[model samples]
Target: MASLNSRVKGAVMGASMTGGWLLADLLLPEPWGDVVLYAAMAVVNVGIGWRLGKFYDKQSDKETAADFDAKKAANYELPS
Candidate 1:
């Protein structure tokens, strides 16, 4: 199966965070201060998700490169 793209992953994470905020607000409405706090938290959540995606992408690239190298080595034939 195809893996989720980095942007898609970040979007999913950010969207889920927004949904959680909505649900929490509905359950317990807060004052203006909390609203502002939540907004900041939402931005922070999105940023964290983006950074996580970037980190994962880097790790995946490294793993892929290592696997390719291993496969190439496995197929190497010494010259007679």
Candidate 2:
């Protein structure tokens, strides 16, 4: 599930960055357009990295909790 979410997030970011670059190229001129496009891409990539990090952290926490729960369950024993 986390993997799926990450893939979808990556796809969306890639598409948006491409679209933004195209739009900037059409609206701006020459060096300025290229500069803007690069800057936008850099910022978007940073944001994507940050988001993915958080998502992975959350997924890890869930997995850790599940493992702990399983260990506790295994250690339990009923009275005879």
Candidate 3:
């Protein structure tokens, strides 16, 4: 599992990269320019998707942990 700091850093990096690629695409000249930009966009999209997946996995793990804690608490019995 990644520490919270790593996850935050990854998300920030992904957002900035995606935004920069988009802005560059708008400013650059045509033909191969669009092609190159699209390629970069695709790469950034994949990175964003991967990052989102990681976040989902982390959320699931947290939910599972909370469920286990709840179960453990419910099953606690008084001493005989």
Candidate 4:
């Protein structure tokens, strides 16, 4: 499994791959080829979105945890 940053990098690579395929298809004559390329591009885009959502969820969880910890500390008292 790759890190969040690596996953984003992979997504960027996927975009370039799709671009290359599109260009190649344009150079050659094949109507259905474009459809296949578009489908692949859509899948990559979905994956990228899912990965980004996961990254944001993780950050939110950390922030929530910190907020809870701070509140707990503020409520605590010590004997003199």
What's the TM-score of every candidate structure? Answer: 0.57, 0.72, 0.64, 0.64
Ranking by lDDT: 3, 2, 4, 1
- The residue-by-residue lDDT of candidate 1 on 1-80, one tens digit each, is 14999789878977887897777666765687577767877788798889989999999999999999999997896767
Q: Which structure is stronger by lDDT: 1 or 2? A: 2
Cα lDDT tens digits for candidate 2, 2-55: 657867987886788788678878898888888887888789779878998999
Pull out the clashing pairs in model 4. none
In model 1, state the lDDT of residue 51. 91
Clash totals for all candidate models: 0, 0, 0, 0
In model 1, the clashing pairs are: none
lDDT of 4 by residue, 1-80 (tens): 35568778888887788788768678755777777867877887799799989999999999999999999987895657
- After TM-score superposition, the amount by which residue 60's alpha carbon in candidate 4 deviates from its true location, in angstroms, is 0.4
Candidate that would win on TM-score: 2
Q: Which residue segments of model 1 deviate by more than 4 Å?
A: 1-30
Q: Give the Cα lDDT of each candidate.
A: 0.81, 0.84, 0.85, 0.82
Which whole-number lDDT from 0 to 100 does residue 11 have in model 3? 86
